[model samples]
Target: MTARFDVAVVGLGAMGSAALAFLAARGVKAIGFDAYFPAHALSSSHGDSRLIRLGYFEDPSYVPLLKRAYQNWRSLEARLRTDILTITGVLQIGAPDGKIVSGTRSSCELHGLAHEALDKAEMARRFPAFQLDDHEIGLLDPQGGYLRPEAAVMGYLKLAAEDGAVLHFGEKVTAVEPDDAGVTIVSDTGQYRVKKIVVATGSWIAELVPQLRRAAVPIRQVVAWYQPQDGFATQPQRMPCFLRDEGAEGSYFGFPAIGVDGVKIGRHAHFREPIDPNQPNPPVNEADLALLDGFIRKRVPGAAGLRVKATTCRYTMLPSEDFLLDHMPGEKNVVVASPCSGHGFKFTSVIGEILADLAIDGQTDLPIDAFSFARI
Candidate 1:
């Protein structure tokens, strides 16, 4: 059987759920489909917590967009009456001149946001859990915090449903085609025809958007949870979420032990081989564990030598590590937003609003030119 709607959102994950909710709130006839439910651990949105900060180290252009994200997140929290975002502050630690520290400082300075720069000794004095090296420094963004990924997804989905959005779970999209009238979506359960389609599929973007197959590489990332040792007893309440640049090697980041009861850490860049999202995730090998263990030991000494529980997640990365939020090449009615490059979760709220605005009005005020496919 086939059904039709004004808008059909494929892949109702973090960004999609919020987009769907925004569209439904506007009284638009929208339908959402996901291979799994909103809170399912199968996708990037399943983690217990995601870091949300205003001073974007990736690029200063993101500062304006992040400002909107903060507002939207608060609006969602107020509407849902759920604590989706916690303002626990954030720390960017690295060499004083490295991207993690310098770029963050640049963004904060450009935006005139409140921030503090601290030397290694000052960092230790303020954030006692971090064992910074002699050359390391820290930039503190007091407005930064963490977002409840699972709760935010569920909250958006629930609000979307309440606003009259239909959702189909376990409906993996098999095909998508654009024609004169609109777009057609084929899935295992059935087919759907809608005037417009928003493809927010994260790691599966290559499958749905063939043009980006080479540009978007799906990578397997492991997130580990560890109980803090005696030195980190104050980590949960006092320590800020942090991003640490390991110099020329790469970078890794982590959040404080929130409701989860442990510190969570993961690398920002490393081995990222493509994978079948349907298959079971690859095992976390000793080498991977050792790498994380070494990171914790050297930088986060308080979090080292603790029991570690790890789970695998996927990141759809674009070449520039930005995002691809634009129409599908020549197809204006079909929008594609994907390959968040592992840092897109924090901006889901604002991205979703942008997608909805684009779907409805054909453009948005958000500074998404950096994320345009034309830039790729």
Candidate 2:
């Protein structure tokens, strides 16, 4: 019932897949396990697409990580021979002094990234779908883009397996123990002992790490796909991906019509009754669809009345809405990365590289001090 490996990765989704891929490529003896296969709808990596932006509005500390993420994504795309990222620009829309606009501007300024600021009149003229208020403005980051979430996960895992990394699907880890002899991973199928263990169990972290469990909250998120009335013409060919902070209502965002699953849109934040990950996602209710419809009606009129399809996802939130990337306190052989807080997918490539580095060298050059467990 017990096997051995050099490194054992739990929850091989975005971050874990990347870690396995990177480790396998480096000739490290790595093995990965997942309760479900990559791109499964049950996990956070299900969405057809995810936004990747360089001008982070959350904080400037993420700028360096994002820079590395961009490069890593490109490298993965080339290695997989598939386009995992689209370089369409991104737009931050809000009041001139609002968090979306002002914070993004500050991050770009601090990092010396190339960006453009536009007033309401100019924004309306350039991107007519957005109905900005009189005092609102837009910050355009050319480096911001969209990533193919499902494709990226599959690509990483596929390449990892091809490079001699063992992947076990439909196997969920139930317990983890780490000591001087390294770590032991127990799951339904069997037990795995390795020199090191990496826990990347997205929303399931609450169940795996009891001490840090309360710090990670799982919440439901709803995303909608609408048929564009006139397709790309109404939204334009190069229309930037948009993030809008509607102040009291809530912050929302969307992407251009990519001809895959209609024009995708969703709110950036929401409140939902928590549920166990093993259970099916709750049904998408009328109010959830209404919220997305309302946003589109006011901001994206072209896609407002079109027939809409909707689905639900989950976000494992940290109190600070930052990532938890570090070694387990008092346990040197165990590393944990979780609670990407709804915004972690885009950085999975770089995060995977960093996780591999941490396991191998016990340290990373990436600026992850702000995302340590001590902060939680």
Candidate 3:
């Protein structure tokens, strides 16, 4: 026997879980499917934490969506009775003219956001953990912080189930065929028919949607956690999340230890080598450690202590590294959402709501033109 639903959400990681949760809350007959269980470490959403910042350096146009995303995140926390977002302030540091510093200042100025501009000395005084060159400056965004990725995913999935969403975990979706009336989704367990479909599959997008194989490429990324030494404090009160544009070495971002007794750091532009998500993730190597060592030695104080652990994840990137959200060509019944390039988890709250809106209403009030696949 086949199952039927008003909407079938494929890949219930971040976006799909939110879509299902929203639809189910609305009393829509929604069903969700995922290749792995929610909050599983195999995918992008498994990382312990994700940074949330209002001063987006990628583009200032993201501020509006971010504002809405913040509200949604708060609402989700209230609804689920779970603590998710933690505001520890954020510092975007680099040369005054660099993308990380200038772009963030531009966004804050344009959006009328509250932020502080600190020179090298002020930065050192305010955040003792950071080591800066004399010419470097820091743009501190007080609203920026981190989100617990695994907990957020589980919360959304749990609420979705309570709201009447039928979820099939560890069920691989083999194909999604759109028809005149709706969409037909075939999985390893059974077939599902729905009036609409939302494809939020992250790294495995190409495997299911052949047309997007070339557009969405998955890149291997590694994140490492290190115990702070004597001088620096990893606690939220002292150290905030940080991003630095290290000129040639590439951009690096990290968070102060939350529950763990270590700080987490990852290169935003390192090890972007393409990988097949279907294959086992390669183990973290010494070269990765050496790369991070350079950053820690130069910038972060007391971050060179014992290296606790490191893990790898896939980053599905577009050429521009912006998000990709749109409907399948000639098929309005199916909406495709790939909000991840690298920094996407923070926006999951609004992305899910947008996916639900697109799948049900066929339109959304949010500004998503920047992520339209038509541009590609």
Best by TM-score: 3
* Winner by lDDT: 3
Compared with the true structure, all predictions reach lDDT values of: 0.85, 0.84, 0.86
- Candidate 2, poorest ten consecutive residues by summed lDDT: 229-238
Where is model 3 poorest over a 10-residue stretch in terms of lDDT? 230-239
Tens digit of per-residue lDDT, candidate 3, span 1-376? 2437899999988878888888888888999998888767668888788999998888999999999999999999999888999999999989989988899999999999999989988876778888899999888999999998888888998889999898888899998988888888889988878899998898888776677888888888998888888434657787889999888778999998675648889999477888888888888899998988777877886676787888888888888888877788889998888847888899999988888888888888999988887776
**Predicted structure 3, TM vs. truth:** 0.97
The C-alpha RMSD in Å for every predicted model, in order, reads 1.6, 1.6, 1.4
Candidate 1 has a TM-score of 0.96
Cα misplacement distance, residue 225 of candidate 2 (Å)? 0.6
Displacement of residue 222 (Cα, Å) in model 2 is: 0.1
Candidate 2 stretches greater than 4 Å from native: 1-3, 234-236
Model 3, position 220, has a per-residue lDDT of 84
* Candidate 2 lDDT (Cα, 0 to 1): 0.84
